[model samples]
Target chain A: MTDNTRRRFLKTLLAGGGLATLTGCDYLSEKTWFRDTLAQGETLSDVVQHAVTPRKAMAREYTPADISPSFRANGTTDPDAVEYRMLAANGFRDYRLKVGGMVENPMTLDLAAIRALPSRTQITRHDCVEGWSAIGQWTGARLSTLVEQARPHPDARYLVFHCADRYGRSHSPYYESIDMEDAHHPQTLLAYELNGEPLPIANGAPLRLRVERQLGYKMAKYVMAIEVVESFDHIAGGKGGFWEDRGYAWYAGI
Target chain B: MARARLRTVYRHPLPVRIGHWVNALCLFILLLSGLQIFNAHPHLYWGSASNFEAPWLSIDYHWSRDDGYSGRTQVYGWQADTTGVLGASPGRNGELEGRAFPSWLTIPGSRWLAMGRSWHFFFAWILVINASLFLIWALFAGHLRRLIPTLEDWRGFGQSVLDHLRLRHPTGEAATRYNILQKLAYLTVIFGLGGLIVLTGLCMSPRMDTVLEPVLEFFGGRQSARSIHFLAAGGLVLFVAIHLFEVIVSGPVNQLRSMITGFFRYRDEPATDSATTRETRHDG
Candidate 1:
């Protein structure tokens, strides 16, 4: 074929291809295939993140000068539950964090025991899904230390955080989960203190997960229990967290 | 005497047309969804950290006895009451809602942040992929040459601006190719601003941050990336407004036809063979 005709033919083919791709996006979004692909996309990002960043790489840390005066607690500001209120009333001295599910040894540790473990202090920014951020110094026990004591079974793949906050009277309580990789990260802390003082009630007093690389919502506040699980399939809404169940991406790293 | 046929040119190639429409759709979805996402937290910051204490930019609504129904915007410590628009507006429900941008302007048209994020991320993939493909194709096909400014373009730029100010458009031979103004604008949109938007967007991703930490550092921090993302989006919105205006001003029928079908008819001059020769050259 002559160059002119070949060019014309190719142009037509390209236009057809472009049109197909555009329509394909529309049709695919409605299909289960697309949803699964997006889910995979989340995993893809996780893989890429792990591949690119060094294992011990930390989230950017700030000095005390950068700390916000009022961090302005997000999500559930106050867990107004009778149990949570009573626990808070007594300075959470009696609070116990149960560590079970897919673990070789199930153990419950009180606030004192948790605070006694070797700790990590980091002044890091908390980026919220809502596009706000705040810096605060978090002092807590390394989650890996707790995971080591719990002795998660080989089948365990995720660390689930069960929290005190339940919104809108949902039958399911507020919870969040992270993969084993995040659970073992050196910076992943079960923070009990903020800005030199004990963590305040609004900021998840007795305990809060500090998965620094992720968004604010992933840091489950007022953590009541820690569960090791192979998958979150049987968890509330089968997505992972309260927000995840409501349609937020379970892997909110991006 | 026999009359010459009116000449037509291949003003827009198939690939260009396809890229244009896809980007347009992506931008529309992105802007609306971005606003929806912004409504989740109406404040913007410069450094990596921000809270109630300080934000370089913030859009919020507050009620006071003196300033009822006022919507405030503060930028770098300078505050203003943009009440009728921006910070707050009459929501879709017709109630005065305190949102950064009104519900009508947001995707899902409600305060469903999760849904907004889903839409944003989904469309973001589409935009990124589509734009990447378009760039590659444009480069390989040499279509980029038409958009990139030259020394001659610089010489003609002032004239083009003057003509634009007077609402004058090129005629005949000059109209066959994009004017300097068009080239510069297209180049900025395609190469400069488009890449900035995408890079800043990637920088905002917590996962991508791990992968692109060094690149994100160039933008300063995550919050800086977010701020740049929003600002670049504003530039895009401005481009679309001016683009649509130019389309209408330059003869929407001809512009629309060229983009839709790749055929553009020039002004008729039955006695002129120059137009036909030039058209043939373009076709060849």
Candidate 2:
């Protein structure tokens, strides 16, 4: 078959749409089946609309002394690549985070430059969706500054964080994203230091996201890059995050 | 011979039927009432609830609800009005929505959440009773083992997964019965709704949050537990929807007859009758 016909055929066969093509579904009412199937399955677009929020996430506050002696990192202990290990050996002094994707000027800012921007230090409870909680003092540059410097395109809606760690057995890159609102929240920061010292590898060392409004996983660790994009369509599996692709909700706004 | 066999065995217990209807009634009220609560804020970003409220479907109530904790709340349920049998005041039985449907899409807020609390607390007993009895019946009657598949069934499930992945031909008999697909779906609802729900529901209330804190932590936090409760409710609704479709696909009367009267009248398709041939696979 010609490429045109094959493409059209594939589109008709695989494209998700109406129930007219539901062969042999004589038992289920077409409408009922369609509704049940579609409603049960979460779509990326539907999720974005649902997650738009006027409702604010209350940040749980904590005493400075409540910080853990050592915050155990759940995933990605070390990014063993040559460049990352070299930086890790020197304690990320030379590390620079590149911010690009749908931006006017793609720029790389070093840790010092990022720290030079106005900073915020907030001691809040980090609630992990996996059923654990920790309180830590996070100090870093306001995320909004980075977004301002990068000057994300008008259509750009999500701020994607590309981390150095890979999750589970899939070896898939650990990444996370947030809408414009969370990206610019006052408490949201590119957390560089935990407590007083530089962030430990176990706790997303050098630079990590601190989106207090969301669960712990929303805070991408071992940050190597940030991408501002229009939608999550081109991202891995198009659902926005690693866990979200595997049946977990994408906008975990609690 | 199959019809005679079906005539002898029982499928859906009378009490189970009652529970089905009760559970249906409870969930409908819960979802709509929950929607009413959601309408109060109306800004959902993900999961089951949304912040957006349908304007055309708005009912402006003249008054407020009785939650004891909060007052002067206006909300509406999904249905247009209370003209029909199901439309009349649907009570909130131990539900999250407490009381009061949104007013924009509903009539006056009739349910006093205080009174709604009584109904909620009351129906909670109904739920517990129905669920407990169903559990006991399923266990004592060997229905759990029948419903939950074994290692052999996993292969069928895996094959079904590949079929679904391929998006091959229409949903055949394998799709009709609670095939491996059905088993997994049921298993999800069981673990999601049956277990997490009770645990989360307890966690939400100040009185019981402490008791169920450990279990709640297994999922996330108090807020996460509440979110899980909502997610599980959505999952249950999804399960019920697929289940009804499965029944309809195989012929509703034939499926319902088995549950109501206790024996499933299986259509003998000699061409594709290899899955299981029996009067009742009572995974009730």
Docking quality tier of model 2: incorrect
The sequence of per-residue lDDT tens digits that candidate 1 reaches over residues B60-143 is 998776655668999986999887687878865675768888765777566778766766777787788888898899889998
All models: lDDT?
0.81, 0.59
Estimate candidate 1's RMSD in Å: 7.7
Backbone clashes counted, model 1: 1
Q: After superposition, how far is residue A74 of candidate 1 from its true place, in Å?
A: 0.8
Candidate 1's residue-wise lDDT over A69-158, tens digit each?
877688787898899999999989889999999998899999889989999999987888888777899999999988999899998999
Model 2 misplacement above 4 A: A1-57, B1-284
* DockQ per model, Cα: 0.32, 0.01
lDDT of 2 at B52: 28
**Model 1 fnat value:** 0.48
